[model samples]
Target: MTPTHPKASLLTRLARLVRMGSHIAHGFFILAVRYPHLANAERAVITRAWARKMLSIFGVEVRISGDNPGFYPPNTLLVANHVSWLDIIALSSGTVSRFVAKKEISDWPIVGTMAKNGGTLFIDRSNRRDASRINGQLADALSQGGCMSVFPEGTTSDGFGLLPFKASLFESALLAKSRVQPVAIRYLDAHGQQTGTLSYVGDHSFGLILKRLLSMKKLVVELHYGQSLQAGEGELASRFAISNAARREILAGLNLSDDTPDTARQTLACPQAVTQ
Candidate 1:
């Protein structure tokens, strides 16, 4: 397997950072203001284009494979294994959907503001009641022909294995009868070998991860979309089964065994964090 890229020159990293900041500013100040007036289809087009540009600014290329549901069908719940903070950007390049993220993410700096404006649904994991409220909102959105993406793993991984899925969120899919599309995401080097160049796990500061990402020569994000799963009529038991099945599909897409441990397959070559 090919190794990760050596750090880019300081000047190159600075330039890329500047471009990304400018792009984000444009989205924040310009596009966000006009988003409310755009139709759903128009919003999707703009969202996809902006997401592609964002990744391009970071010098990351996204390669989509498997049952690629172009732009994702309406009322679909796109489930995926979490790998990096950049996972949203990679997936958004091919499909447009509001994301379900933790309440803490909505409190982050620019990212939080952007996410809120981009129609993300933030759930307060510490509050059990907040989950039910979010589920109601999800069902309402999906019933209104909206698409959403949720990472059932609930945390970032090292792109080698997956965490067990939280079945509670799948309840929204059943409520709306939304199709669950399992997507497997990976951060790889130019040669297509998996790399932890972008894993945003543990206590690594966001700024530190950003700098490492900026320094990488080439980062490839692969999204392997599995077949759409029908939620069918279900109670708690059915939701649990569906969640497990989704995890299985994602693991298969990552070419990992169902019993694969959460340990990293290869050492992450970037800055390491001592704790989450």
Candidate 2:
């Protein structure tokens, strides 16, 4: 009830901060040490619990709808719109899945090390050849019953809109013949108005974002898990078609307008088109 309790006592704020720091430290230790030796199932259990603790510390609640991946094919791929780094935290809270992140993220301070330990696959979009490499690796993982997710939008967007998805990641599903699940993530305030505080886009530096997040009273994210399907589930799907289907489903779930411009085009990579 941070919103109603605006004058949060110094002790209360300090408590939240200490708890958040402790959770993050504990998570880092697990990722850096113990998790690496655990079986896939054990890693999933520990990571999911750690993520939920982190979410609770941040005072961010995730409300899930549609088909929770927790109950679906374990080897499926999850595709979703990217809003902020927090998206990963929210998703991890729902279920555990390896993430497909940008190569830059793999070098981002503690986050980078943590991502590597959490089994993230880093994509260097500039190198087309790397796509095939990742595809092969992803196929191997999928065949072994691993679930992976990518923000096919190729970039993050404000909560009110969505960018088209880039099609490359779908190659994994094609190679593994796995189901692709489209998800939409949106941040809302206490009164249910769209909140952009969680967006890690534009000129927002990491430090600025951290400050804003810490200052905010509460954050609510809605996770809409849309339909999941394989290339030949209904109509045969080309990679482009699959990518489009994922984006379209996410757009619908967030109730975002299709015509929303690519606001991040100048700064973020504007892929040819949005596709699975």
Candidate 3:
């Protein structure tokens, strides 16, 4: 028997697809032409609008908790647990920010072009040197007062728990003297239970994931923003320390134990804990 939530009908899904196509075209135009001339405020508005529209088309809702910081402060670095490709879209819906993503994404069909124009930095994982270059670029971006984000896990996992955060990118925040915002993201069903219907793990293709998401009965993305970490002096300011601290805040926000059994290839979780 099916759950209480009703899945999207074929007609509704079709309508959504049509609208998404149009929205993508509009985004391309804005990024290719208008974005170059738009002021930062205007660009943030466009980015938020575009992302919200994309989520709306996929029938996803966003629930935010904690002291909502509203717009991202300049020279801020947002670090979050990566669950799926949708994480990027969900975060973008909140504010205008650049992301450090896998280099392969830069080659994905239409989305690749949009990501490039939208200021996403792509890192080639196979090359160790790529991380240094990305860190340098991230420092430069943060120095210029541009808000940047990265999935410090260096890969995606099921939302049940977080992978150990890689410390490489945290150096950028320290170098730029930017505040680090630790955000815990969770995908839930109508009943508020965590769901893996949105996890983009394993060998899933983009088209396959999109189709699954579009057919979902209900989706709610919870973003728990922890207290922003200050760039303090001494031991606390080291990249390793900052990374661990950020991970701890995210773990608290997720209500997960330090030794939570690994079900990352299996399930999802949404801890009611608040860390604002």
Instruction: List candidate 3 stretches off by more than 4 Å.
Output: 1-5, 263-276
What tens digits encode model 2's per-residue C-alpha lDDT throughout 1-276?
112312334565577779988888888999988987898888888878888888777677888898777832477888888777788878878867888766877777887898889888877866777777887888789878887778887677765677766787687888788888888888887667777765766676556555556655667889989887786456635777888888888888988667866555222432211223
Worst 10 residues of 1 by lDDT: 267-276
Relative to the true structure, candidate 3 reaches a TM of 0.90
Each model's TM-score, in the order given? 0.89, 0.88, 0.90
**lDDT to native, each model:** 0.78, 0.74, 0.78
Report each candidate's C-alpha RMSD, comma-separated, in the order given.
Answer: 4.3, 4.0, 5.0
How many pairs of residues in model 3 come into backbone collision?
0
**Model 1 clash tally?**
2
Q: Candidate 2: where are CA atoms >4 Å away? A: 1-11, 260-262, 265-276
Worst-scoring 10-residue span by lDDT in model 2 = 266-275
- Comparing candidate 1 with candidate 2, which one achieves the higher TM-score? 1
Q: Is candidate 1 or candidate 3 better by TM-score?
A: 3
